[model samples]
Target chain A: MLNYIWIGLILIGLFVAVGNDIIDEVQNPYRNGEPFVSTVLLKKAPSGIRQTWEGDLVAPPDYFNGFYGTQRTQEPIRQPAVISKSADGTASLTMNITDASPAWWREMAKSAGSKERLLGRVVEFSVSEDQTSARVQVVFESIRFVKLKAVTQAALDYAAIAVNIALGLIGIMALWLGMMKVAEEAGLLQVLTRILTPVTKRLFPDVPPDHPAVGAIIMNIAANMLGLSNAATPLGLKAMEELNKLNPKVGTATNAMVTFLAINTGGLILLPATAIAVRAAAGSSNPGIIIGTSIVGAGCATIAGIAASKLLQRLPRYKKAMEV
Target chain B: MGEFLKNLVEVISFIAIPLMFLLFLGWGLIKKVKVYEVFVEGAKDGFNVAIRIIPYLVAMLAAIGIFRASGAMELLITVLAPVTGLIGMPPETLPMALMRPLSGSGSLGIMTELMKVHGPDSLIGIMASTMYGSSETTFYVLAVYFGTVSIKNTRHAVPTGIIADVAGMLAAVWIVNLLFR
Candidate 1:
């Protein structure tokens, strides 16, 4: 009956995926290649001490060109900067604004009605004089505001790809888990459960070592440790459900279940392939950081998880349960 | 439509060619492989999982779009600026952080923009790249995992996943500071 249910779910999931247009949308690439041009006009004073500098930045030129690809009068202005040019073309002019109160970028963004506000206070400028216009290279030393919308957008795009890949793995693992369920119904899980009896006894003192819940917990943890998080979740839930099934009366948390959740949550595994793939996709110069960090982070999380679980088990309620 | 076709061609040229070669190698090394059967089975599975998570994916995508449309993400960066400064992260990285959770391609676009804006070697540009490589989409993971298992208790998962994300974010900043700053 369970086997049939599993197969049915898989079939239904597949049917829906093909029937819907989500995949097409996800797989479809969006072309956003619009030329952006920023111009700053500066008028030089005769002595060159400094006069005035004004600049305008145009982002996503396509947006300025209306939906019909025609130019519009009111284009979205991203960052506007005003600076003063130094008297001598060689000297840099610095502007001090410490007495002025600095406002939070978001507050400014609210008034501007945009997500990002131009950040940077003018620190200095280098001027070059020509026949018609004085060209100045303005240096912006610090940002007053930073907007995360673009970064978050990038993260989401990466996650979409990751989710797609993870889903593929989940589909395969679901098949494997289903097959494993068949093995269990045929008594394979029981045999494995007995083989693991000693460790299970030590690990889960609150639950009877021979309980079906123990087998389920072991299988669930095994799946999680393999980095198949989606596959691990259902197995872990089923284990908890089976454990609950054993408790005829339940008002308190069990040491075994609590410990199981902690371990499953902290399951340490390396996904170098995924990390490297993401790095390559994101155009990283070094992809090895994924490998190095995973080893360190996963190691720490796993240890902390074990320590937390052990400490929780030592609590008075859990200690008393163990004693019982 | 032409752009879409061009993108399709680029994807095929970039991803499909390499994957096809890898598949060929696998087939040559393995004995008695039912190539067509395996291909059909894999495709069927991919199609299935994609369908099962459609609503969740759509919700996430739409939420991302709205956030972009509404300028909430930009607001978030403004809110985080002081903290970002204390950590020596570039303000330009704001967009990359916002885009990372919603879409990979979108993040790539942001990263490309950053590279153009900051010349890749700039501290913020490097940090943005690092963060891009370091973190995962917690919400997307939650949606897909829960959507597939039909488990609704996101109680512990959401908090834990976000904690990991914060840690990843800090790590990216700290590592960049140590290496570059």
Candidate 2:
């Protein structure tokens, strides 16, 4: 099943990318003009009064010399403008430029790797537009074709994703799983499972009362709830091994194992530490805001998982296996 | 109230780390379970697990990248936008939702990209983060767990897991709209 899915994804992706590329090629408006942003208007607020100045670049400046309109002369194209706030601070200065040339409206686009130009241009502005100073803003109105190159690049970028994950998981998995090992040996898992036994017993009827697998199942769920994913896997695997001991059929998953897998896959995270970190890295103001939502969503998912597994196990096809 | 809750959460996190460490060490000592050695024993298994899932990880990640690049994802979102929009899920988040169950890194990458495009404080960004945390990588978990035990006939697990994923996505949309909107 996984094999077919993998192949299907790859084939579908190729077909779609090719079809989109052809359409973009035929429909792209920017194909006729070199994407450029040669003219920039610098607006400065000196005192309460707002002043506007036109900053002109050398006409037909070398586009290949480097971005920011920096020609081969290596001289700065536009001199630095100083800005100061008014004493009253009620007035705001803004640039109002009306040039429809797409070149004048070029915006920075993110590209993969060091050569960001592979997809598009990311011009580094050398202007002093600090917040403390007069707020400097760029106003250019131009249009460009949708960035299609990135789609192709991002497809092959998966290898890098795999490599990055492979490298990162080493330390993370080691530390968390090691802590879990200590916790397990110290009987912390047993303590947790004891607390969750009533719920587990209700969830897994096939597992006999007083069975060790019940404790293991509860431990797995508890680890996941604490956002201890590293520990959850080992405990989940351990639980599966225990449940398998009771399975009459070796290769086929038993009812208990399926139920456990469903719950495990549904997620039981109380705190999503990793997602918060990602948001923080992305410079979010409130990285922790998702915590409440995550808990609620995971709870709903877990309920759905349990309900589905219970309903599915009662089906006629599975009834014979249950009777056995 | 939100500010107070945030601070309380911060305090719990600050305390939780050290508390967990002490709990393990003190409990291990009381149980006489050679905490250091047991830790090493478990830590060693990490390398084995990482190595074991390398193929699965690489295969899934590669497929995800191709799928995203192929414009198929864009098409999928476009096709499903009306339905998802009616449910308050932005079209941009469809990739993350679809990919969340298949691959962990895949969904994480999509979520990161989405957050980058939309400021993390934006409604879309909050929704993505909530979705990211609310569901497990169902297919990846299934592969690793069942592969470890060589379970060939995984009956009913896939459908159950997918149902859970749908429930998770819905809950994420509803909850984020309630809390952050």
Candidate 3:
């Protein structure tokens, strides 16, 4: 049931987030509170008026890779940082996290105290004899509960995204629905339905051969095959509305609706345009290579879906749901 | 043959809509139907239908989003990786198979990432793209369609969709391995 599946996702997500945080707590992958030793190439020296020193923190790729136990970066890390000593003599380091930062640190920077810069406490700063470079030991601000924070953000973001998606559908939905309305009014649907009766009658035995729902269903499936999704969705919804009229019980699905939805979800398309486009963009030698494979896959899906819908509708539980 | 088929479908897709519009409205004119008034009358339902599905979509998508962001998919792939070899599936594309039925954008992201890491002509890339084309996002269609109709008790629709998704994914794996591998 949707209730169980929905709740399962929420519960599993919450538990996994907590579980991941716990694992992170034990493993300490971020090396929180651990001193990081690296050399800085100082660009600006302290003057009489200012004790702030600005430099680029540099680390060899091998050292970083070894420390993180990851092969995330090949280029050396050279990130700009400012070290300023307070009147009490404790120094703090602020590093602007840029695109050139190691992938691991950039990920940590997302949850850092400052979203843009990584804040760290200078444990020991020893200037080189030439005064142009220094070796520093610094511990970055701790990062924790990453997955949990992401989970919360995603819930909020997806809710807004969902509304945006629906709102965006208004224009396309209106366009297709209007055209479908005209087709229905002009006896065009009846003529098409008549042509597809043998197929529809077998696919949906419970529906009358001449039902308007049959017309919408045929149009919807054709739209789907053509990958005209803007048209398919509106037509499919129209089909659902018409199919609902024949339902003996309100708020429950009939055999015809199940069959129709199965076909929709099967998604038997003549061409997989999105995939092909992406393949071409990704520079495939044969971008349209998946056409045959996709057709075969979708064909199997359609047959399996139609067979499953027919077989499952006969079960006592599904049949019971249909009863008034 | 492939080039011809591609061009043929391209032409059809290009002209199909305009031709359909001309035929439908022109036929309406012949039949004495008040095309504009009838069109506006029917189009009015579009806003209502779009608005009605917002709640269902929010509920479905929010759950899926949480699941995705929690890094649970990675854990799932780790667990399912061993069984992938039994089905002739490249372990890397399992995420595509899993995400396809849940979220359209999520599966697309996986497909693109797979092709980026592996060359587009490689077996993994081809299989991932094929998997993307295999099936519709089942849960999304379920939410939107049933939400529009306000059908709370979906009965066997969920199972039917799951079966279709599984069949589609398996068929993609099977065919891709048969030809490409």
Candidate 4:
């Protein structure tokens, strides 16, 4: 299943990227080689014989929407731009895309070879009588294969991010592992495990309820319920290690491990802190309104996950996977 | 009642770690367990464990990142929308449900965007936030936890995770529509 899903993601991603690129190629939505005729309000006239100009690229909202074939922007375009003339008199326009730039241009600029700037050929430029405004027709740089470029970049970036996430875990993992070690050595874990044996005995009947794995599992679940994910992860990993100690087949998951994981993934938290915070940040009047709903959702997930894990472990295939 | 519950949990969250540290170490001290040496002995394995899971994490995350960046999720949403719409789920929040199990940050981004577009108290926003809270990032959890123990050929974990995620998402949509609609 994991093999199929992993490969499925990659295959689907690549196929969709190629498909979108093909559609973009046929559509030519970026209007490659087509001139964008607009007016520019100059900040100041170029001094002396130097043929460089800097100003605001102005376009009415209707014209901009019509040009882009969408109504993504409601306001007029007043993006800052610069047109530079070479010694031989050929001119080019460069617009640095900022937050003020229209969303379409930003999307185009991001897909451009440059990350946040749009480069274009300034085909025609004429100064107004007042020397404060000019008419310009620019052919913006072509954007192609945007999704493919992003997919390639994401593959590389996420690999590095994965390494960073693992490395970041070292400190917390060490802290919790060390504390749990001391607790284990002190015989503290057994006392807790004993108190919870009746409950865990049913959940993980294969393992002795008094085992240290039970202790770590309890700690992990408790921390998770409290929404302390930082603490929960190391503790969960510790539980896995202890559970693996009981695995007859080293590379295969045991029934107890699967059950424990089902509970972890259920994500039954007392308070969904991140969601509430985001709601509050989004100016919600009742950010806490979903607390009950989240609990209900997660509770169902937890119960369903445990039931599924228990039922699935009885299947012949999963049972065979446990064969040493 | 909700406010009280929220406050109580907030206070507990603040104090839980410090209290655990004190209690664990304090108990170890009274038991004459050589707490420092024992802790250092256990801490020695942390670096190895962290390094050991790099490959698995990279494989899982890169696949998900590619799926996200390719805009396949949007296409998936379009396909799944009508089917899900019949179940009382807003088509817009479908991304939240789908992304929830795949990537944590990605789902958060979707939830935030949904809230921005629709006020956070609206049905879509409520459903999206509930979806975010409903389930863990199952793939990530599986990768890190199983990676730690070098478990491959995950027999039923994937299906189990999918079942849980589906149930959670459905529950989220059901309850949100019931209460918020």
Candidate 5:
């Protein structure tokens, strides 16, 4: 299923890039003959050339809004490149705002209406000496696009991501899975199972009351609740394996498995410590403020997951397969 | 009120990580289980599962790279922005919404980028972080877990998972606006 989507993306991207005149033929480093690499500029499109000048605005410049249409209709804007400021006024600044789409670029160009409206408070606004034109020449540059080189580069970067993921998982997986083993051996699974029985039975009517899968599922959910992902995954796989043993239909997901998958994907977060850590590292004045919001949002997701899973099972397609 | 809630969560998390280990070990000893051997056995299983998932992870991640590199993601977001905007989603956070289900690292990267552009305390940053915290990497989880068991026909899992993801994204926008904005 995903294979088709992957191919479609590559093919469609190539087609679109060609049509949009974004596919640039570049010299292939490996080949001696011709330009083998086709680089497509996706997001970075130059709207137009602006008179580049350097000076402070008499006051903060009023942001233009036309390019951003409405909440739904707006195109994404690239973060403007910052110029290094000097104590003396000599830094170069470009008023041209390149956008993701050409339409937005045109909108930006049109929005730079009058000098009195835009540059009244600005100390300096002039065209750079490189160009003879005083008019703001709209130049479109597409920053985000897909090409063979980018696709290959992106694929190559995955190896590093894979290694990092594995490396990060090793210690956590060893520790958590080991402790989970201890929990199971210590009868904590049974304790947790009993505690979760009522809820699990309602969600998974197919499973028997005394099945070991109930315990495994409960423990998996518990680990997830604590943001113990290293443990949660192995435990989840373990639970799925146990559930598979009970499944009469091979290669097809049972109701219980689908429900579990949905719940796991819903992922109710209690602390969101990672996000908070990121906020703190990023210099947020109040890192923990997001925690309450996290709970509300995740709580809604989990409830939605449970409801969807349960309701989905009742549909004719799923209900018709019920084991007597 | 927000401060109190934050402190409460802080206290619980601080105490929980240690207590969890203590409870497991203590119970194992009390039950007279061979805790060390059982743990070793389970860790071996964990190692094997991790090895097994690498191929699935590669497949999923590679697809994500292609999709992202193609700029298909931005296209999708642009197409959906209007409808999403009506529901309170900011256009800036659209990429994260699209990426959250398919790839974890991808969404995290976008979240980090958004936080950098708009300060973490900004509305966009809070919304991105909230969405990040609430949703799971749906396709990644399904691929790895289903691969572990070799489930060929996922039946209704995909739609169900997507439903949850959409719900999470919407809730993130709503909750952040209410609490922070």
Candidate 6:
């Protein structure tokens, strides 16, 4: 029955991926380009307020004014600007000019009949004194401006659809299992009981090793640690069911299950794969830090969870359940 | 003292990462498939898991997007400025801290922005790196785990998980400070 549910979910996910075009949207490689000022260097520094690119001199263009119109060009080209070289011979150059003020930026916008304000801009050049004709690469590493809302909105809409489909598939599978009652008939309960026996004993030593509720608790934790929360639901429900099975009265919470849920919710320390994925997505040079942190952080949390549960169990109400 | 402990941790980490990967490889091989196949299967499982928890992931990602898009993250930076200042943490790292709980991708986006804003060697960038190392998606874990189990009442789970998250955050900050500062 579980196998069928798994197969069903796999099919549903495929259908959603195809039908909603979520796969395409997620894999979309569209990037936004907004207009912003960048610095470009010239063979000789312009005397007026103009942007310059920094780097080794490439072959001089026939005309600098052709690349940038006369309106964009500044006067009084600066020369041999202070070139600071690092130990590796990577030189940094800066251009000093007085006319390029915030007001000049505002006036430039006003002259262009545009309402948008101009942000600061700078040009960097790398000049190889030995190789006067070295190829110059004008790298634009930074830009500041607004983003188009339509593109972002479309991207998010596709993400929403994808998430909906995933939830729908998981929900359908959970309902099918609940309706069929395969959890009881297939002896999955017994399997879980056997699997969790030692784990329950080790994690919740205060509870009797042979307690009926231990199996359900362990199964739930295992499911969660594996990042199979949907699979964990039945185990949690079954654990609750078993806990109630032991309880003469229905609806009364058991100490063991509460502690179990607490620890499970606190989560088990297998690996922090989700965080690692995020780190990788974020473009971190190292995504492995999550592994160490997961061990230490989750390990600590598990200990704290156990300690808290034990401490809570010592209270009068919990003490009564422990006696059983 | 902290430096010694950190170096010790790094040395242990150098060994543990490879060991863990090898163990996974061994398990895959014992299952009678090539290691690459096993890895592919694992990756496929990850995709399935992502698909399964899409709603939760989306909500968290959207929240993070809103935080960034609406400039709430900037506000958070301002609010945390004094506190971070006292702790020797830079104001620029507040975005990364906020991103840690919501979406790993979102945090990474912020991390990239930070790396660009401040060079990789800057203290804030290093702390951001450490925070990325230390934290997990608390709500995503809850949603996936709880949703899987169909458990209704969160009870003590939320509090305990948050506490754990706080511990992870503090540990990352402390560890980075001790090592770098």
Q: Better model by TM-score, 4 or 6?
A: 4
DockQ of each: 0.06, 0.44, 0.84, 0.88, 0.46, 0.14
lDDT of 3 at A143: 95
Model 2 regions lying over 4 Å from their true place = A1-4, A24-188, A208-217, A229-252, A274-289, A316-324, B1-5, B14-18, B34-44, B92-96, B102-126, B176-181
What DockQ class does candidate 5 belong to?
Answer: acceptable
TM-score of 2: 0.66
lDDT of each: 0.49, 0.68, 0.92, 0.93, 0.68, 0.48
Cα displacement (angstroms), candidate 6, residue A81, comes to 34
Docking class of 3: high
Instruction: Give the TM-score of each candidate.
Output: 0.43, 0.66, 0.96, 0.98, 0.71, 0.45
lDDT by residue for model 4 (A159-203), tens = 999999999999999999999999999999999999998899999
Clashing pairs in 2: A17-B70, A36-A103, A37-A103
Kindly report which residue stretches of model 5 are placed more than 4 angstroms away from their true locations once superposed. Answer: A1-146, A163-175, A318-324
Give candidate 5's error at residue A270 in angstroms.
1.3
lDDT leader: 4
lDDT, model 1, position A52: 54
What is the per-residue lDDT of model 4 for residues B31-117, given as tens digits with 9 covering 90 to 100? 999999999999988898898899999999999999999989989988888898689988898888899999999999999999999
User: Model 1 segments beyond 4 Å from truth?
Assistant: A1-174, A182-269, A278-286, A297-324, B1-65, B92-135, B144-157, B179-181
Tell me candidate 5's TM-score on chain B: 0.86
Look at candidate 6 and tell me the lDDT of residue A235. Answer: 49
lDDT (tens digit, per residue) of candidate 1 on A1-324: 212323433343334333332333443211112222233334333344446554432234454344323443343433344554345533322322221212322333332323343233333344444422333333322322122333334336644754565456556545433433443444545767899999888777768876777877777765554445554555564466566565434533345554555454443444424444544555666544444444444444444544566665565644554332
CAPRI quality of model 2:
acceptable
lDDT of 5: 0.68
lDDT of 2 by residue, A56-82 (tens): 322233542443333343333442322
Which of the two candidates, 1 or 3, achieves a greater TM-score against the reference? 3
